[model samples]
Target: MRSLAGLAALVAAASVFLYLLSTHLPPGPTRGPPGSAEEEEVEEDGGVQEYRLKFPSDLDELRELAEMLKFYNREHHGYVLLLFCSAYLYKQSFAIPGSSFLNMLAGAIFGPWEGLALACLLTTVGSTFCFLLSSAFGKQHVVQRFPEKVALLQRKVEENRSSLFFFLLFLRFFPMTPNWFLNITCPVLNIPMPIFFSSVFIGLIPYNFICVRTGSMLSEISSLDDIFSWGTLAQLLAIALMALLPGALIKRYGEAHLKVDGVDSNGPSRAEVKPVRERW
Candidate 1:
């Protein structure tokens, strides 16, 4: 109950912060010149609605919101940036889904290079915040709620302990991995904070780059399908495989050197190995 209450309070605080930020923004269509293609598209889609700060769920809504924010970005650049950072961090810290939309939005507003940099930085920082929150308030609840999952992840983490950073990189590279789960459970698995932070920062670059780049061309994209097409999936899979190479080599080396009937041939005995395994 205490954990839940703390989580709720944090969420409420974040919501209030967003509300305050939203209030500071001037009304929609405040700066852009008239009848441009961007303006025409926005007008055809029922004109700029009042700027309400929230997550955009689909392409049309994303386009509308992007257009609205772009208009605001012209005159209130600092506030727009702050609002984007705050919203990105809020979702990231809480493990909320739909960051792809925001990543693209960043691209639409900030352009490709800037948006990519921003996305990568915010993703790392936000995920780290989530890790810290989970460390402080979630370990007990996670273990209790998902005992089997916890045990499985604990075993996997131990198996990759020798090359844990590379293993984490592979997970981050693989698009299918549940990153939120990783963030929440990593502390419970005893992963180091430096490794966690570094992995998240370095590992998510490709994904963030893709989203930001697509966002840079937000005007051209038709749907999320355009972002995660077959070619993109292949690229992500290949990157994930490359990230796994170091870890696989480490595993193979350990097995060759240490696995002689489940004990090192010239070193530790079974009894000694027990202590080493426990030490992990």
Candidate 2:
């Protein structure tokens, strides 16, 4: 009876966690999804219009504006914004349209924390959408249409299921991992959704903050000097360096405590410790 109760509890907890991880973001004007008229990768008019550069001068004012948005958010029981963000991302991955523009627009709607939270949530949900689509289509279908670089992603996911969370983190940090590729193959790899989403939430949080803060800073940025501020680079680099810390620590500690002593070093046995060849 106790064992059954424990099992039931575990299942319920897992279910709840899954529900949270799979949550989506709410939608707003100008944000539809992937393949939507506005979000097309290949716009018939040529390329995406250059993002306009218009930022308010005062950061305090921007901060206050973000706060006001958050205040109004109180009326929703909670997570309504997150839901819209999630849905937008998921829909975008599917070609709903206007996703690119709205990704930036996310800065205006949700401030840093909420935007970061919702972005992380939505990115995971979007990845899952890709995963499902890829699973349905298969890799052969994926490679021929997409670029050569995409195939490598499929191979990595195939070989490295155990370290996928870390790999995903690295990819999200570097901004190199193709979200669509991961989306398509993860389900195919049979990676449990919870592990995938937890990684997404933790990994992409920094990137979301960057976008949100960048949006907030847009007004102040004018000249090239303002555009490439040293302080911003330093902060971003510091965060990036933090990701490498675990690797550095592992190497540093692993080598320091070489398990040599009682077990004997790899060197030849000492004369005292070595027995003379006996004629047994």
Candidate 3:
């Protein structure tokens, strides 16, 4: 059993390596050549195939890049090329923890609603890709390293292998579940791409909406940039605390009545807890 588990881990790792090797495009968002590119894909596949972002090699600085795009957009009718490149980079550069910066930039460049929408779309797509890659290569080792967290997410997924949308929704809505970890683990567990996508479709909308809309207001808004602002930080903390509420309640309710698993009927069982579906 251990051997088989090891083999599965090896295979998953190999799959991720292959995926990394297979892509040339910079990850998040890159520009498309407007109508012609769209037409080519439409003509070939009857529907356009969406590309997974890999990462940009050229621009080391975002502000400079944004300024260039701003200039081009002003010169032309719009900045579709910039949109494409930005999206491509955002999606491909999975290592960066990019929300606050991206939101601010989007607001500065794109205004509120559209800027927000773009952020949400870019994030969802990028996040999904990361999930796939991580699940393919790192989930096995990830599970080994963080068994508790892995089990928590596994139960969440097990309930919805046939319903990824529900699973994604559950994970997204529930602040307790680790969204990043789940993304990587889902593929390794063989949740179909379509199903994985269904989860994204339903799950990401609300948070996306919130962040993007808030960002869109950036052009008109002027506030401090404290990472730990009072109001917003308090709200975030509240949400985190709210998720822990259930466990707290359960513990308080059963504190005195809890029994040892290995105890015989007459007394406390001392069976070694070799990990058996303990929920947090």
Top lDDT model: 1
Clashing pairs in model 1?
none
lDDT of 1 by residue, 1-280 (tens): 8988998899999999888887767655632448656566566667654556667999778888887777778877988899999999999999999889999999898988899899999999999999999888888887776555555556656777887887677667653337888898788888899999999998777778778766776655567896578865665566566556654664565455422232111322334332112112
Model 3 TM-score is 0.49
lDDT-better candidate, 1 vs 2: 1
lDDT of 3 at 8: 62
Query: Per-candidate RMSD vs. true structure?
Result: 7.9, 17.1, 13.1
lDDT of 3 by residue, 168-269 (tens): 555555434445655655655566677666665556555555544444443333356643567666655654564455445433433343321222212222
Worst 10 residues of 2 by lDDT: 258-267
> Each model's C-alpha lDDT?
0.75, 0.48, 0.49
List where candidate 2 sits over 4 angstroms from the true fold: 1-87, 95-103, 137-140, 143-151, 219-280
lDDT of 1 at 78: 84
- Per-structure clash totals for the candidates: 0, 28, 30
Per-model TM-score, in order, reads 0.74, 0.46, 0.49
